[model samples]
Target: MPSGRRGRATWLGVLGIGLIVALLAVAWLQVRQAALLRQAVEVADDDAVLLVYQAETEYLRLRDEWSRSSDPRRVLDAPALQLRYDIWVSRVGLLHNERIGNALATDTGFAETLQRIDRFIRRADAVFAAPDGPGPTRVALQELEPELMSLGAEIHGLSLRAAHRVGEQIAARNATVQSHNLVGIGLTVSLSALTLAFALLALRQMRQLDRRRAALEDLAEHLRSARRDAEAASEAKSAFLANMSHEIRTPFHGLLGMLSLLRDTGLNQQQVGYLRTAAESADHLLAILNDILDMSQLESGRMVLSPAPVELRALLRDVEALMRPQAHAKALALHIGTDPALPERVLCDATRVKQVLFNLLSNAIKFSDHGAIVLDVQARDNEAMAELVFVVSDQGIGIDEATLGTLFRRFAQGDSSRSRRHGGTGLGLEISRNLARLMGGDITVTSKPGEGSSFSFRMPLRPVQAVPAPRTLPGDAPPPPRPLRVLIAEDHVVNRQYMAALLERLGHDAVFATNGREAVEAMRAAEGKPFDIVLMDLHMPEMDGIAATRAIRALPDAAAATVPIVALTADAFTETRDRCLVAGMNDFLTKPVSPPKLAASLRRFFGSTGGADFAPEPAAPEPAAAGGESPPLVDTAAVALALQAMPRERLAAMVHSFLDQGPQLVQRLRAAVRDAQPLELRVNAHAARGAALNLGLAALAATAETLHEGASHLPAHEIARHVQRFADLLPATRAAAIAAGLPLPAGAAV
Candidate 1:
């Protein structure tokens, strides 16, 4: 062949190979899509059939209950049966909703199977609803009996066909994948050979055109320089984004804290309402910011789900409680009901579920104006598969059909007008839907022009069986019967009062220390016994929880050295929580402690309810008569030894520095407030946190933490509140410090 024809023929061969490869890929994609569709339909069918089974089981159960009932119970069984029957009807609708026939288009076997299941349901309903007068409904049930079996058999047959189809699709995909691999290998080898051939030809041409070499060299050099410049610019852009995020977060925290405090301030009714609305708006803003952070993390493939068994009813109730306030404000009737058939608990991500439910309910409230909102949970069935469905419906501004279609899409609001009115980042629904699907479920919406709209989120959840409680710790070995005397070291009056009440309720006597140093002193003065446990607050004046715990655990006496120390803090972040555990604290409790949590902690420390054996020994005999004197519940020498474990000079220095600077810091904070400079107010507040934290000034550090978190967006008065708090802290902290006999720096008055 002539050289031109040979070259043209080679190009044609390459083109043909490319076309064949593309066609195969398209076919493979179609097969994969078809397989997914079939699987979905099968799942839907299975769920429908499962609901039917549950209905049948319930019908039989109710009938049996009715047979055993005398009067009132029989009446109850009738209503229960009716409820299950109605649910069964709804489950049939779910199957029809799948539109499997239409979706498969030409999958006749699957279509017929769905039709059979529908017919079987009608027959089963007739037998299920028959009056109790019948001697034997066997004949009536027999009609359903064959159809039920056949329906199942047909479904099974369809499933097999679907499976076979999926297998074929898989084979096709494998073949296509193999073809692609072959094409790629062929292309690589062919291209390499062609390049080598071209190189040989180019060498000959270069030999003939050596005069042009300098131009090519200069072009190559410029290209390399441009590539390097582009890379550097890209890195700079990333750094800028990171810096911006960090900067925004720091000030945003301040804004949030101030807003929280403002919410606590006294205001007129209307002003209070407005403040609440503003706070909620701010909270929503913070959530959006957090979502962006989460999205970034998720995109980087760093998101991991820590799934656990969750009590679904409890989770749902919590969501309803949170939204009830919003509904009440709107004067809208909000009703929440659950399916009688839904398992009490399920294995899923509880937090994610709550987040999804919260988003849906919030939307329902936001869009509604007059009519009641109803959230109904039901056990939906399609054939044999069971799934839980959550429906949130409202009589508010309904979404148009056009917009409803894209309701769950990312960053999509119903329309521009709604987006403006609602003021959302439009990520709530998308995140909800993603989270739903992540948990083997999905979210969908249905709305009409003027009526109400309903959003239903459904997920496939595994049925949970209650596990029997453990009898005892292994081998029937009982825990030690030592009496537990707990020392509670907390500074906040309200918190201290609440903890004291909780401890007293648990049948344990508690000794209170207002600050860290007093707690240490109390332990040191005890003559006879050892305090079994020390519940230390992370932020306290004079000496804080972490240090106090370290001090106590380092004591020379074996009982004192080994006494369990639990940390109490307001921060629930992983880093903070982990630090307490690593610092030798046995456990941690977040602030606003509930009674149950408090009791649980006590139970963990002391076995069974007879009585705690640990006690703190009372100091010196001069204060009490011999008969009234209790045995020393703590060892003073051991307490002193623990305090000496850490470098005494360093601890003393930190204490002196905090006291020396306290007055000046307070003065600067007051000046900042007088100037009405929020930025300066927050700067002082941040400094206060570091200083107070070092000195174990719990109350001041918490106030500082709050101010630092809420500084950027808080109103002026909110900033003023923190500044006032800082001033108040100075006097109380000095008094507590002096009372504990800590040396104050010269001229620093207590």
Candidate 2:
């Protein structure tokens, strides 16, 4: 039973036992009172007055016998007279009993009267016992009669007093019995009252129990209804995000394509500038859309993680590479420390792990005013397994306990004021925590206001065997003698055209397929002359790349089925890539595809005998500027490589196109600053840097890199200065291009 019910039972049982015992005591008391009253009545009936009365009767009889003897004719037989005297004397002796004696103890004559009677009996007995103990004579009888008669009167008086005393005692006993009856009545009334009270208490307790049960039932119903509503809402939100993602991405591809194609069109620097700004804004929107898609996938439980052996030092380098620029921009120190005991290779989802670390480091840089952000990696040996812990501590404006509770919540920021200064989707921490939990780990934070916050991420450490050394690029190499035939499967017309131009420049034969269905048909038609590779787009009409890859694999032609298939799409989600891989694709790539990235993908599948590692290594740092004069703005090596790849006319066209677009890009930079769209500014700067690097526009790339580095935090004035530097670099870039023998548009400054 419940404790509450058990307690109630105990109290009720005790009360009932007490009532029974009280009743038993009352019964015993009544029995004792009856016994006492009976004893008192017996005592009242045992009065000495009765014996005194008997004695008086005997005395009267003796007196009559003496009178008869005195008459002589009545011839008193002396023996009979003596017998009557003796009988009277015997009756007098009986008066000496304790009851009679006590009744007259206070009367002085009571003892004297007893003595007088006894003396008379003795004298009469002496006379009657002469010779043969004859009866009392008339003279002796007269003397004894006087004494006996006087004693009779005294005895009668003593009996009257005894009767009065007995009457008082009986009266007192009767009063006691009346008091006992009153007490019994009171006890009965009290027991009735107590029983009634006990019943009322029990009824009240039952009523309370009923009320509590009803409340609990109502609460349960409310919870059930709330759960149903939450599930329905979650489903609705998932559907909405999916629909939005699909709807936005379709046209977004076209927008991206249009922006890329616009670069080749002839236009003034200002017009080119507008186009670059639009492209950057589009990229920012795409990034935000990607974040939302990820959140949706996570919420709907569709996100998948692929774990592999990852090197700790190499992964840290990757993180530092991405974070170093942001830290440099703020002049904030970024320190990464790892315990010596940390394993060189541990099993983890490298990409997801990097994503979480990047998010944490990014937030630290955003919030900290001047203090350092420290990332410490260590391994803890738990009984079951080792746990790898990553502690990211930042001396930022610390979060209060009140705000800490909501820190990892989606769309929640530490403080409302910070939200304006440091903008974000606020899904980073939530995503990180969820990912950590999915990997059999958790994320926790410790912080105090005005101090700093330390976020610790701990995941089970499953180590793997060391991997062999990674492949390195051959230094200053040329392209291979053989140029492979590549098939391009793309649904976007502009993208297809761009790919064709790029392939043509690279000295390769290009086969085109507008959709997955045609791409599959093209391979089938190739017959024995199979294509070297299939660059498949994930999203397409008439069969998506994943399905096409599956179809090709199912083909009976082993050569065709085994052809290298690299997924090409704008979708950056790991789940999308994983699905393609599961469908039997060889590789994945995100779009607005770059030459180096494309080359790397190709090198991964095909041997790189021609130009291994096409990316330019960062040049050695020159001495600090002499007389504060800026160094040369462009790197000639990339221009030389471009010339080697294609005609100078083609290289010139690309450079001129980039120069013409510089002014517009700078204008967009200014506008983003004015609108306080830091993320937009960052995207624009990043794109500018990438494109500049492609054409070897070194100074412009440097300026864009600076702008990108500071976009999220730089003051408006500082950002404006960077924007001006970009605008000034346009004419400088055109002159540099001309100095390096690259083409420029008509009426260009050079």
Candidate 3:
């Protein structure tokens, strides 16, 4: 038992023992007192003394009456004489009582006196038996009086003896009561002392408890203060990290951009090799920066996963595409396979999954010189949930058990020798494991010295139905057809120059704005000749990209208000992307934007035929009679092609954006039809048809096609009917696209 409880139990036992002893003392006192009281009651002297004294007094009275009866002077008073005799006999009978007799028995003369009195009374009863029987009653009375008078001395002696014996017994009882009182007082004092000691013990215990409680309160306060200090320190660190990331990446993007531009400068063979080596080093530095950022986000609990329905095979293919080149350079074999039970599509964060696989595969390739690296995927049943497991095995420098224990720890590498040979930030495995755990899974490794290592990553399996493949833009297969007028909003001069050079190389005109204010002013100044697109930088002075985009969206001119604005910032955070999109930007592109990435973003808005230069005067749409079949609700083939160019989420957003604009298109078509302006009607229908075709909304595109084909020759009522039909097809097309496994953006209305 705990010491405190044991001490309490000991105190309780002592108290119980004291209580029992006190109770026993009280009982003994009570018994002694009761015995004294009983002794007093038994030895009462009043009855014995009174009985003997009365007997003597009656003897005197009888003797006097007898003397009178014997004398001639009293006449013959027989009745009076008999009464006195009877009184004397009755008094004598009382003296014979057992209580009085026993009390006086200590005097040996008591019994004899009682017996004589009884004998004399019996003799007197004969005379008194018949009141009228004799005239010689005087003689009878005279005889009884002598005997009664003789017995008086004996009775008087018995009275004195009873008084003496009772006095002795009373004295003895008083002594016993006094002794019991003394013992009871001593017992009471002992019990009171014991009770006081118990009270003192209880008071001491209470004081000790109070001290413990105060100490605990102080400790708790210290813990709370420490926690607050730690939190403040952590916040400061996170702030420093974010600020440094921005400061570093802003220049880093320019460096990478210049490197990209340097490639086109017609260099000799040796210069080209030097350029390639510098670019590789730059890429390696960028990778380290990304690892640091990832680690910081993971530590601060800010890394969020964007899980969606991803095609399993496509994700694996993407990993293979990036890793195969590294493997070929090392002269090592790379094999990737999946179990037949694996689902075709599953719900997961494709980007994070690919990142983890990339890290594992890169490590394998880095360590091994010639042996094969295998990535095998399998499915397993874990109780009620299904699990997907990825195993990466490499014939590399295997780790020992001692090193394996610290393998996944932060900044821990395989060994000191290997760490020196192959330098790294040593955060890739840690970051990968953290991401796996965030997704409700974990990563584990098994290795033996001089043998290969196998690392396994497992996560929950959430299968989803297959979605239609995204349609590919013509830019994926061909170059741009025409140059676009591009607006650049940036604060840094180097970034602005890099963007200008990049756009010029893509055969496009470039306009520069130093900040958001200047960008908005540039849009307003364009007036009749608006720029084809706006490339917004988020962290510019005076006003940021979000505010500038919002301001430009509020423009009175329709062309300026509707121009596509893409965020081009160094901030790669998800919240930044969401803020840009919510502020009405068309798309988001992170820092260090490559030529191919920029080109792809442009192709998303303007197809291969190119910018607004070709949009205003579109070719007339063919009539429905040219094709007998009606258009389907959604074109799965076109959507499949788009998937090759961009992600499904990006395509879904575009579809939703186009649908949200349906009401505006319907209003414009109605106005054109009401005014009977074929030119206006054709322009609106052509724009809608182009947007619908790009997003694979076949039915809406077909309806717009009809309106465009009939705009000139058809009646106003026919154009109005086509416009109404176009309006009716919007809701159905959205539902068809969503049913085809393109999820709507978060928090979007159904």
Question: Per-residue alpha-carbon lDDT of model 2 for 190-289, expressed as tens digits?
Answer: 6686678668778978888987997898899999999999999988987888778888888998999989998899986657766865785576457546
In terms of lDDT, the poorest run of 10 residues in model 2 is 609-618
Instruction: Arrange candidates, best lDDT first.
Output: 3, 2, 1
Mark the regions of model 3 whose C-alpha exceeds 4 Å error after superposition: 1-240, 252-291, 468-750
Going through the candidates in the order shown, the clash numbers are 49, 10, 13
Worst lDDT run of 10 residues, candidate 3, spans 611-620
Ranking by TM-score: 2, 3, 1
Error of 1 at 200 (Å): 75
> How many residue-pair clashes does candidate 2 contain?
10
lDDT string, candidate 3, 308-344, tens digits: 9999988886677567657756756566767878888
Assess each prediction's global lDDT (C-alpha) against the native: 0.62, 0.73, 0.75
Which should have the higher lDDT, number 2 or number 3? 3
Please provide, for model 1 over 635-686, each residue's C-alpha lDDT reduced to its tens digit, 9 standing for 90 to 100: 2332232233223443344455665566677667645543445677666566
The runs of at least 3 residues in candidate 2 whose Cα sits more than 4 Å from the true structure, single-residue gaps closed, are 1-237, 248-291, 294-296, 468-750
